[model samples]
Target: MKQPNILFIMTDQLRWDCLGYAGHPDVKTPYLDTLASRGVVFERAYSACPSCIAARAALHTGMEQAHHGRVGYEDNIPWKYAHTLAGELSAAGYYTQCVGKMHVHPLRNYLGFHNVELHDGYLHSARYSDIPYQESQFVADDYFYWLKQELGTAADVTETGLDCNSYLSRPWIREERFHPTNWVTDRSIDFLRRRDPGRPFFLMASYLRPHPPFDAPSHYFDMYRSMTLRPPFVGDWESTEELKRYGRIFDSRTGPADPELIRQAQIGYYACITHLDHQIGRLIMALIEHKLYDNTVILFTSDHGEELCDHHMFRKSRPYEGSCHIPLFLCAGKEALETFCPSSSCRGLIELRDIMPTLLEIAGADIPDSVDGTSFLPLVYNPQGTPRTWLHGEHSYAEHSNHWIVTQTDKYIWYTQTGKEQYFRLDEDPHELCDEIHNPVYQERICLLRNHLIDCLKNRPEGFVEKGRLSAGKSYPPTLSNA
Candidate 1:
């Protein structure tokens, strides 16, 4: 069997329901919609940790959050994994190259990518001054250096004047070509032209857009600026007080104070997705132009999701579907599509960690026994195949930490600090509007899920469990950084 090229595309902080194929009312993602029609879409994919670094850790290492040693958003964590997706692919004779954000510690650390054109957008920890030469963002981030070269040394994200983590929206201050989204695609196309043609390639085109700063190019922003965007899901079970939990700028934990601001942010976010979709289309065209389209397996997904004001939450690091659920689609090449199913949707729960083994399977590379994720490649022909029964998700940030057990039909959640329980029937209430934990009808259901959660946490390294029970009020701080 011949090895097929793998084109893995990832976006940061994009929601699962933001695409037109997801039945989104207004977000126009024609390219993605078309791609979905030609691919198998994983309807229930999720990110276990629901934060950039931890989620990427699971993605890169094929290990769950607990196994990867990061349960929350921690920066500068040196990825010391001996076995990585890229490493294995490279070992298997694939030329591995990453064109965008890796989010790994010692920011420039390529893990096992033969080369990385790194660009993690506006990370404060990496940009902080007094950084050592080995860890300096100025020297590490290829995009930052390129931006300086194009816009002069004085150029910075501040030129846009939008808060990096805020709900504020704006058009890109520079030319659209200089946008990070465009840069990733441009660099990826360059790689296609310059790669070793004899060897099968594993190219990761990772875009940092649709994440935050809500900055899209003017034309793309115009596409949604006047359009009526989808409103955030304000669940009846969610406390209104959560809207006021944090201020209105820079890492706002809660939703916006003004409802109009929410609309603006959604417009910007949707625009970013569309902008990203256009770039994806360009890259696909480039693949065809380079004669690599029919023989390459293209996978599109995200590291995690952004709340976009869902349940009065604005960002990731939560157990809610808005933050944890992610988009996943795989389109095998023309020749490979004969064995793979297309225009299909699978309900089996898939996680970010699954990407590693799935790609390894496609490349005929060895799937390490240490990997916690199982390949869904078998499901291409057997869509009805039974997958993992459930997925355990958790994240710790601010004053709260959450642990959750999600199955196909329902999700049960527990707040470790507050010991609050919430349950939602995903089959009926996909938006999670009603929490049925207090409903007597779900007592047995809730108990089953809680026990599952307890079982998952029992042997956790963080010791969130004690004697087969979750230790309430336990504080698990971020300790997985390179420091």
Candidate 2:
């Protein structure tokens, strides 16, 4: 029997609630919604670590950032780990190809991808540019010339306001023709059309959009012109605590923007989503068109959620649901989809570490015993089943960092600094607005989660950044940096 192919589509900084099926009234995610209809949608899926480096590294290797040691923005994996999904699959007689942003291993960062077009997220970049072909441009791979062509001009990329971190205050351009996203789509489509017809392939096409700059093509910007926009869940700025909580960040914008600006931002976000959706649609259609759809296992997800001023924060790094949760859609083959449902939705919590092992299982490849994640194929197929008792995520945001662990009914998070660790019960307070670490009622549960975090840190070496910065037991090294 011929092995099945896997097509994984990942979008950068997408929210879990934006998918139409997730009940966002304005998001035009028809393809995603349809995929949801046929596939298994993990409603509570979360990024193991909210930051790009931790989250993506975990996704690439089936180990948490703590184990993989890819903690900071520029940290690269030392090459002892063997046979990533791409490498293993390729070795198993599969052609592996990757497209778009996968912010990991800086140069030629194909963990296992034999053919790749890597695009790191703009949010991850501390710099910005419009020149498509700068000799000094980061990761000057094959996508540059195609970017120049589809995006019209290199100068427009910065001017057009599609840049993810571009300030929302910039003067608007309603008639801008091409954007970075268009180039992404064009290149992806070309990649698809040019794929080898005979080989079983695992193609991962990543899209960076609905992320920032709040810019899109003229058509995408006009998507929500006549629609009534949904305000932020916590829109009121009366509370000083929330404002004070995010005082450290530079891009925090408060006070209201012009309705048009808000609309354009939302519209830009939706447009990017719709734009990406169409690209995935084309991928699916190509699969069907080439008679490859039936054998292809499609998985769509994002690195982390973006905070569109949810708690008055702009980009993601916080521990809020807005920043932690992401959309996980798995359009299992016809057999898998036919057996999908909503009964007791994927019971126990699963983390980013689980993805690699799961992908290895789906691909029918050998699972590296070094991998830290447990396969969820049984959970995906079993309507009443789920994964582990807890899925954990950790992030070192500035001097303050949070460790998240959740069970089916209970959620726990611990953030330590200044010789104190704060814990919260998300079941009691789903929004996680208050810290109950000191509370006597949940002391036992809090202690359990704290122990878990400690044990996780114990797996690393003494000199490891993760072990030193975030210690479970032995005196943690003073600072968690290369400095």
- Give the top-scoring candidate (lDDT): 1
Per-residue lDDT for 33-107 in model 1, tens only?
998898888999999899888898899899987778888877766778888999999999999999988888878
Q: Candidate 2 on 1-483: residue-level lDDT in tens? A: 467778888788898888888898788888778887876677767887776666776787787666666544444343345657677788877888888776553445678778887555453332346433332234353454445554454533455434446425332353332345554555566666787878778888877776666655556556666778786556222255645654433345331234455445566667767766766776677667767777778888888887765555556766667778888867766532335443234435666677788878877788887688887767677745667677766666544455666666555655544334656555655545666767799888877876676666555444222633454333333223321
TM-score computed on alpha carbons, candidate 1 = 0.97
- In order of appearance, the predictions have TM-scores of 0.97, 0.82
Model 1: CA > 4 A from native: 245-247, 480-483
Cα lDDT, model 1, residue 13: 91
How well does candidate 1 match the true structure, expressed as C-alpha RMSD? Answer: 1.5
* Clashing residue pairs found in predicted model 2: 87-112, 101-119, 164-212, 164-213
Candidate 2 has what TM-score? 0.82
> lDDT at 262 for candidate 1?
84
Best candidate, TM-score: 1
